[model samples]
Target chain A: MKKALSVIMVVVVMFLASFTVVRSASAEEVKITGVITKIEMAADKKSAIAVLKDNKSGESVTITITDDLTLDKFKDHRIVDGDEIRTKFEKEGDKNISKMFKKTAGC
Target chain B: MSGKIITIMLGCALLTTTVQAKEHPGKEQILKDGYQGPKTCEVCHPGKAKEFLGTVHWKHASKADHVDNLNHKEEHGMKNRIYTMCNGNDIVNNLKEIPPNAAGKTKFSGCNTCHPGDHTIDVGSTGPEAEQSIDCLICHSTKYDFRKRKIVKDDKGNVVMTQDRSTEAAANIGRPSIKNCMVCHEAAGGGALVKRGFSMTKEADVHVSKGIICVDCHQAKNHKIPTGRDPNNWASDGIYMTCVGECHSEKPHKDAGINKHTAKIACQTCHIPRTGGAFSKDFTKWEKMSNGFYEPSTLKREVNETAPVYAWYNLTVSNTPHFIGPKGSRTDGKSKIYPFKLFQGKAYYNKKDGQLLSMDFAPPMATGDTLAGVASAAKILGIKDYEPVPGWQTIYFGSNHQVAPKGKALGCANCHSVNGVLNLKELGYSAKEVEKLTTPEIYFEKLLKLQQENE
Candidate 1:
């Protein structure tokens, strides 16, 4: 009986430890990269749109920004019709993910 | 001796009489006859007389009785005063004689100098031509020499003044000159004293400098003058929007292009309200449709809600005296940090829940007050109750901070895509079918291209 109880205790401890490790690993941040494909300006010239793409997947997405971002950010980024890009994403919640560019280069 | 003396006297008398008749042929006669008036000549030149009456010159100094025919009321200090007549007697009395007004104040000298036409006829007076009612020979025939003050026949067999005739000289000598209209209508304050409600400013002389003539837009017919003021006073029986006139037809917008269809919409429909005059910020009446239609749903309600309250360390301060909940930090509290407990409504530590809550209620800080104070004061004021629910507490500090739905904040992947490409399907675009039109990718490209070209 004592031997069996010890084994069960060890298994339960490992299960909880593994659960913590899994949760922490899942919370790791991600990075993403792509070429700019579009831009939109607000009527008041305050906000603007910048659409970027994942070169590998050919997937495109749009992002809004204040006047902070400039045209130089996308210059010489090797962005074209079918260039490849890598991105990293961090899950914000069940429905949203915050992404940032890891690196961008010619494919 | 008697025969010789009588013969000499008869010859001298005949010579003197002939010279006197030539020098002042009809000066006294004309002054006494008071210009046979335009009516008598109208019998011979009916069409010309009719056209002359329609000109702005004829309406310059009409009788007050004739001017008052329109439904215009003087604004500011000029109460009950009509603008169409000059403030003199000869013209006013002449106008009165034809129209007959009980409250006739006889004064018409100024305006009459230009509007030289007779709407009425005295039985003994000659018609329009005899009264010099802008006779056709004056303009078409170019017969009257304005400088020489004598009749001259033109090459076309018509009577007219030479082109070199000064407008002032013509007007002073009883002829139509363009300067007559400028004397008042120009920015120099000769035209009608523009009162309130008109879009023009006191210093605006755009109408004059643009070479827009009074007669170009204000056509006259019969004895009636068509003014921008009212249709009843207009010579033509048609509806005309003030914006439809020639010079200002498509102004303000160089390319947007305004037309009759657009003018039908009130000027204020698209233009944000301005203050002062009809275009001023205080002018709200223009929001009404020109056709007298009202849509309650589209009307923007004036923001009159009470300002929000603020609480710190269990002490509350509000614009209104009513307290809605526990106060913030009191004046004597040491920390000045009040423990906020949201009751009645659910409070969430996560921003998503708070955003959801904000969508239904007032924004957390839109009232320019702290949310804790507002919630507490609302409870005290019986506006709402503060009931604490099971949730984590998130502290936010900022002026005018807006809490948006969780998935829709600025830095989300769905918002800022990798390479400026937009996934329309992620932005609730599919439900609205916005994807079928131009996708965000196309829209952004077009905008960039247009911006480059414009630059």
Candidate 2:
């Protein structure tokens, strides 16, 4: 009876530790900043995709946007190629992505 | 008895001589003889002949192969054997050709009424003298004597050396009158060929204020005479009125400046009255009445004026860092991120119906958004502000402003603001939406009324 109780406690501790590690690894924040390279919309226009490259790291990233994103507010903000963009993202399952914040380009 | 008989016989002989001299040549003989060419006149009137050659009338004659001695071939296999009635048509072949008769020669008697001169008697070195066929001197009287080659001026300042042989020649024999232009331009059966002319047949009835002669607009030098309808011979130069082309330079509009940036808009777009002739209602009527006549009433009047307008918007999505990741094992994990980016599109509207016409999406890169990549990601999750508005996005609009009387620029709130809750609307909206929805407060009550009536 005593041996069985000790074994159960060890199993519980191991389970908790493994759960914590998985959460930490999956939730890591990834920062991507760059000028957008290309943009494309899905065949049905239900989704939009933006290809971006990190300015400092020179790494390319693809961002997928759903149609529900209300884009009409930034009417005055004209977007074009070579605009510097800074974005923050966290791992969603295995993918690192984030909602965009601020964007600036030459007037 | 012998003296009386001799006198009677001489009288009889004189009568017979007079009768024989009066008899004219037959039509066939006359055509065969042909007119003396203009070159014959050039020997005596070189300066006048040069001036005549410069005239469009002379060009028309040449184009029609009207010159008695010159041989011409139609440019595009056009058969020149057909007959036409009008000298205007024959001189330029401006109209379709008529059929030929059995005589093997086109009867030009009616054509000669305008282009008068006997073709049978006057002979050139090569053939018949063309100048003898009602040529330049028929309109412009000359002072030179062909036999003596000396200029002869009449007592009353007339160049009597040459005669005023044309039916429409001016009595003054100096300047060609507006009557000359009116001969063809005026309405037939006492109708004014050019209705805009100043005179009404009688000199006293002339109204100089009405308008000038055809030459003012139709610049005689540029008069395009149609040789044939063939594409090669077609006149490429477009016709212009007095209000257009280089001379006036003044467009008939107050906001002509707009044309500088985008001249593709036709002038008739705004100056609607001038599209047709004077018989049409003058669009300038509004401008004239507004100056002092029509008094503005307290109640607004609705006018049906439609024009096109364009607008744009952007979306940016952001959030605070929350849970790092799902818990599991030993290795440390990064925070999960859901990126968002901006997309742009144009909406058209019909103000009359208060309905959206269509939406044209700009390519994603054209939005010029730095956050486009991340924002695009958020867009996939339906997490941005100002989602597509159905009727308001694209519409045709109208306005009350008399000058620009098109719909005013659409406000940001029309699409971004939440229905019925102003404060909640302001707070729940995105930062881009909050900024756009705040300004240019529209008279919503008036808009509601207008919109209700339109619907």
- In the range B405-439, model 2's lDDT, one tens digit per residue, is 12322222333244421332322446566556544
Estimate, for each residue in B368-448, the C-alpha lDDT of model 1 and write its tens digit: 122442343334334442432223212111011111222222221222243322333432245355434344553465447
**Model 2 segments more than 4 A misplaced:** A1-107, B1-45, B50-56, B59-113, B116-128, B132-171, B187-211, B219-246, B250-252, B257-455
* Candidate 1 global TM-score: 0.23
Residues A50-80 of candidate 1: C-alpha lDDT, one tens digit per residue: 5557544556755444422121123212122
Show model 1 residue runs off by greater than 4 Å. A1-107, B1-47, B50-178, B184-210, B219-226, B229-455
Cα-based TM-score, every candidate? 0.23, 0.24
How far residue B369's Cα lies from its native spot in candidate 2, in Å, is 79
For candidate 2, what is the DockQ-based docking class?
incorrect
| Candidate 2 local lDDT, A9-50, one digit each (tens) | 999999999999988866576667677787666677665556
